[model samples]
Target: MPVDAPRPSAWRLLLIFSRIGLTSFGGGLSGWLLREFVQDRNWLSEEEFLNGLALSQALPGVNVKNMAIWIGFKLAGPAGAIAGFMGIIVPPAFIIVLMAVAFSKLTDYPLTSIALAGAAAAAIGLSASMAITAARRVPRRAFPLLCLAATFLAVGIFHWPLLWVVLGAGALSVAVEYRRLSSGEGI
Candidate 1:
């Protein structure tokens, strides 16, 4: 968001997050959030959203929930963070319980299976789109590209444990960047 942009109220943030939580499906809530806050509303700049996204992904909880709080804090402070957390979590949690009960009885239907398959396909597409977006933001440098390739091969091709790959790759990336910055070649 621009420096001159008006800040949204906590109530508005809560309402938007609640709506997103209630309506979003097929996963990729992070992608939906990027579109909603950055592209559609211009409430946050792309860089801000992406930075929060990276942090959220690195953290231990659900990415979308972490993003909600991050965004809320950026836009509206602590109260907004509370609103965002509640908005993104509480409503959907209740709905999920209800949906689980309903879906349990519908599991025998072929249509149910088909619908689930379709949802899964959509989810994969959304996740792929998000991944591509993030990848595009990576600096087109040898070290970064090599790290990206190594991480991809480790996690995607070799099926190495994700935690270890992330830890190792992240540390290497940080050390390299730190060295580069220390040498005054930082981009």
Candidate 2:
């Protein structure tokens, strides 16, 4: 978006997101994105990248997909957004279908289950690591921390419906932040 910064072509954007999408196994895709779009390419700043990350997470769908859209839109508007969405989804979609078919055929084998379990554990680790990295950027204030914990407890422990929890918690959090801002408290 910068005048001086050379923008990547839409094709290039697709390729970049596609590569990240396909190769980012287990998890840590967001980390890969941050490194590629922010650190390596210098297309976006750290704050901008993190803000997109937060927005993507707060939204209901897959965080990585949301982030792909956000980054694409930021870089090249609507068409870029389409490219980003397709890049992240299309190639992997095919691969996943193929894998599912293959896995179904292999389901009866003990080694298949063991391999999948190991993969699942590694995926969890990657996700947890990403969460911790993202959490470090969250405000260290009591209110924010309480909100985080409440959301986690509701969704993770209580198994509350995510829609209601997100709406209620998001509204409350927004109201609280608004009040703080109105009171001249720095966010």
Candidate 3:
């Protein structure tokens, strides 16, 4: 059976994406964003979400912000994109500014430093969790494995400049993808 196309609704799109922005915490909001719009609501298909993710990563901006713009445009055109961008940025910016003020006032205290150290540790743990989750979802193939190994070598072992590491990884990924395509594998 053919699926019906979704009709755009600006207010609904604003409300939903805003709520997502407000609630996302401890990182990995990308997966949660996918779950909210693609799986739970069926506003986007899995393929669409994946494509948006790829595009967002390629763009020169925060991944989540790029994603919000792309998804918003997909849902309700340019107006939706603006709304989504504002909804995602404003509240967090306001909260962060307030937190920065508080942190500045408390910077000299040893207890504050200790508390920040603990928060940093928790952030690292969260980052590792996100990495493991993403790794589990990656296809287990020789090309991907090679790319991963090369990335580790470039950044972890050799301590190459970040730009070089990114460029090398990106080139390797493209080469692998090209080889896969030539071998008649689906992308």
Best by TM-score: 1
Q: What is the lDDT of candidate 1?
A: 0.90
What is the Å distance of residue 41 in model 3 from its true position?
0.9
Question: Over the full model, what C-alpha lDDT does candidate 3 score relative to the true structure?
Answer: 0.76
Q: Which digits, one per residue and each the tens of the lDDT, describe model 2 over residues 1-187? A: 3568898877888999999888765567887788789879999987788889889988978989999999999998887898899999998888899989898888889999798788778767767866776777776899888988999999999999989998999999999999999999994
**Per-residue alpha-carbon lDDT of model 1 for 55-127, expressed as tens digits?**
9988998889999999999999999999999999999999999999999999989999998888788778878
User: Candidate 1, which segments miss by more than 4 Å at Cα?
Assistant: 156-159
Q: How would the candidate models be sorted by lDDT, starting from the highest? A: 1, 2, 3
Clashing pairs in 1: 1-45
Prediction 2 global C-alpha lDDT: 0.86
Query: In terms of lDDT, which candidate is stronger, 2 or 3?
Result: 2
Q: What are the Cα lDDT values of the candidates?
A: 0.90, 0.86, 0.76
Q: Cα miss at 156, model 3 (Å)?
A: 0.5
Cα error, residue 142 of model 1, in Å, equals 0.9
